[model samples]
Target chain A: EAGVTQSPTHLIKTRGQQATLRCSPISGHTSVYWYQQALGLGLQFLLWYDEGEERNRGNFPPRFSGRQFPNYSSELNVNALELEDSALYLCASSLGASGGYNEQFFGPGTRLTVL
Target chain B: AQTVTQSQPEMSVQEAETVTLSCTYDTSENNYYLFWYKQPPSRQMILVIRQEAYKQQNATENRFSVNFQKAAKSFSLKISDSQLGDTAMYFCAFTTMEYGNKLVFGAGTILRVKS
Candidate 1:
């Protein structure tokens, strides 16, 4: 089976600009998630969407937001990008509400470079 | 809140040798899940193994296995017959039902397999 796939493998943006990363989940999956992996800060959960609705969000600011499409694809939008925003943004998908035994599958992350 | 920690930032081992990566997590929930993910230079997150908190037996996948200590709250990954393809960044993660299944990740350990 094909794993999750992400687009725009790399992105470059200036301060105060916005960046958008896209992801397509594996077949038969209905949940999408976003995570940010900073150089030294580790991976932080960004957002979670299930069945086309926002289910949960991380400690990140409101500027970091995203949505899941009807087909289970997702897009992460980071507004007012700062130098600190530069990092590897990873997208993952899972089968939701199946007794919570869902294990997530991730895609190739998008490297966002904010100047 | 939950926190995961990987004390070893980097580790190396000869090919075909055995290596272990340590991880510790703090959580108040009685039931949860632990996962190990490998991120290669390609920046794709691949699930290495998983251990459920309530499961007495550890989880194993092919050459990868986990040492889960519930009382001590420790979950470590052990790779047997390591290969060059095992070189990657390994992350320890946690999730609970109350947390809406959002992952709480550790800083990560970089594992390098030597020839």
Candidate 2:
């Protein structure tokens, strides 16, 4: 089965410009997650959507936002991007609720380079 | 706020050897989940192994096993008979069993397998 898929694979944006990254979850998965992996930072959770609702979010700024569509695909938007925003953006999908045993499958991340 | 930390920034393992990566997390919640995700040079985030907070028995998958110490909030992954394909970045992550499933990750450990 095809795993989670991310678009562009890589993205480039200038400082103060806005960036949009996309993700398509597995065939039957209902939960989608977003994470940021910077040089020094490991993987920071950004946003999560389940059944078309924003279930939770991390400590990131409001400028970082995303939405899950009816088809379980997701889009992460960063407004007024900063140089510090350059990092690998990862998208993950799970089959069930955020339960302990439900492991998440991740996509080949989108490398965002903010110039 | 929950936080994960990986003290080792880099690790080296000779082929057919064993190497362990350490991770620690801080959380007041009694029930949660822990995970070790491997990102290869291809940049795809893959789940290596997972451990449930309430499970006393350690988790093992193929040549990968986890030594989980709940009291110390310590979770370490050991890869036996390491191969060149193991070279990549290993990230330790955690999430509560709640609805959000927001995963918190550490700084990550870069494992280089020497031939």
Candidate 3:
């Protein structure tokens, strides 16, 4: 079975530009999660989608947003990106709705570099 | 607000040896979950192990085991007979028992296994 798949393994953008990262969850998974790994901040939760509904988000700004599709695919959008936005963006999927025991399977992540 | 803290920024262990990484988290909620994830050079975030807050028994997977101390709010991972393939960034995360599985991650520790 193919694990979660993310698009544009690497992305480079400039300040004020908009960047979109995509993710396709594992088959039969209904939950997709997005996270940001900044240089010193480690992995911070960005957004979460379950059954094509926006569930919860982290402390990120409003510009940091995403949506889940009918197929359980997800897209993370960062508008007006800044240099601080350069980080590794990860996508994870799980079988259940809540609880951490569901075993979230992660993608290879999208390395976003903002100049 | 929940927060996870990994005191070790980097760790080194000789091949075939054992190493432990420490992590602590702060949460007001009594019921929650904790996890340890590994991100290799390929940058795939993989779940190493997970411990439920209510479970007294520590969670283990293969050579990976967690020392979970609920009273101290501490969770540490021990990798036995480490291998070169174990070289990666290890992150500790926490999540509440909410509807959406939102994760709070720490500043990861980079583990290097020397042959």
Alpha-carbon TM-score of each model against the true structure? 0.97, 0.94, 0.95
lDDT of 1 by residue, A44-111 (tens): 99999999999989989999988888888999999999999999999989997457759898998899
Which is the better candidate, 1 or 3, if ranked by DockQ? 1
Please write out the lDDT profile of model 3 over residues A1-115, one tens digit for every residue. Answer: 9999999999999999999999999999999999898887778888888999988888889999899888889999999999999999999999858445477899989999999
lDDT of 3 by residue, B1-115 (tens): 6888999999999999999999999988888889998989888888899888999999999999999999999999999999999999999988876626888889999999999
Q: Which wins on TM-score, candidate 2 or candidate 3?
A: 3
Residues B1-115, candidate 2, lDDT per residue (tens digit)? 7889999999998999999999999999999999998989999888899998889999999999999999999999999999999999999988886636777788889999999
Candidate 2 regions with alpha-carbon error over 4 angstroms = A98-101
**Docking quality (DockQ) for each candidate:** 0.84, 0.78, 0.75
Label model 1 with its docking quality class. high
Single-chain TM-score of chain A, each candidate? 0.96, 0.96, 0.96
| Of candidates 2 and 1, the better by TM-score | 1
Write the candidate numbers in order of decreasing DockQ: 1, 2, 3
DockQ score for model 1? 0.84
lDDT of each: 0.92, 0.90, 0.91
